[model samples]
Target: MKYRIGRVLISEGQLREKVKELGAQIREDYKGEKVIFVCVLKGAVIFFADLLREMGPEVDAQFDFLAISSYGASTVSSGIVKIQEDLSTDIHGENVIIVEDILDTGLSLSYISKLLRERAPKSLEICVLLDKEERRTQPVNVKYTGFKIPDEFVIGYGLDYAGHFRHLPSVHIAEPAE
Candidate 1:
């Protein structure tokens, strides 16, 4: 499948380097803490996998995947957050990291953050693969960010357009239908 709009925004190599850097930073900041890496599912699988490998200093922590939904199969966000599957681990007294593909609109991520906070995690922060600065309507502080993206539809490396283009090696815009 060919791209509809722009070319690759962030190539695979570029993504790798950024993730490595973020991992190193995280390792330094939370060296001795009990870090629980919680990756958001579907869109963040690839980013999480790469990032987890990049993190330095062995952490005696746990890893879990949270499947959440704020958007349907369309490009537009519905703004309603829902939990398809919840985390099995109790977040009590744990430093948790919520990893995601992109931070746009901020509703979903912010809601998730607050929800997790209620579980009594010792600390919680966000780490996103891509940050669409222009699309952020609400303020969200992500501890780790891989790239700052333009306000364009992107797909690849676990992000998709109607469930397609996720297999692309790099990020690409979905060509508009004429």
Candidate 2:
């Protein structure tokens, strides 16, 4: 069960350092306030877990999961976003942060953000591990971003190709076999 991984774009050490830095920044930004971290599930689970741990005891954070899909099992998005799962907890009046693995095309995040905004949270923000700015179709305001990558087919560090290659510690562009 081996997958062909392309050149490593971001190393494991880099991700660790960035996550810590982002966590510290998040703590400072939301100081004295409790934040409900809404993780975009499946892909973001790994990054979300690591980020929460990095936030340490100084930050007051709760968590929920929202599963939205635009990409099925393929490397490219279908351009249509669908909510596979919804939040379990009520976020009304709570400071909400949407945690996502990658911001590609911005369709899913944009749709999710709009949906969450309707819930009337005290504040709403977005935190993403990776941002593919070049492929963005919609303008999404991401508050905290770990990395801004070019438009590439990437996998690992929680990103995946058809549900595979997520266990890799580093991020790499996926070079499909001919």
Question: TM-score for model 1?
Answer: 0.93
Judging by TM-score against the true structure, name the best candidate. 2
Alpha-carbon shift of residue 146 in model 2 (angstroms): 0.8
* lDDT of model 2, residue 81: 89
Q: Give residue 19's lDDT in candidate 1 (0 to 100).
A: 83
Estimated TM-score for each candidate:
0.93, 0.96
Question: What overall lDDT goes with each candidate model?
Answer: 0.84, 0.91
Candidate 2, 49-107: lDDT as tens digits: 99898766777899999988888887888999889999999999999999999999998
Off by over 4 Å in 1: 1-6
At residue 24, candidate 2 shows an lDDT of: 91
lDDT of 2: 0.91
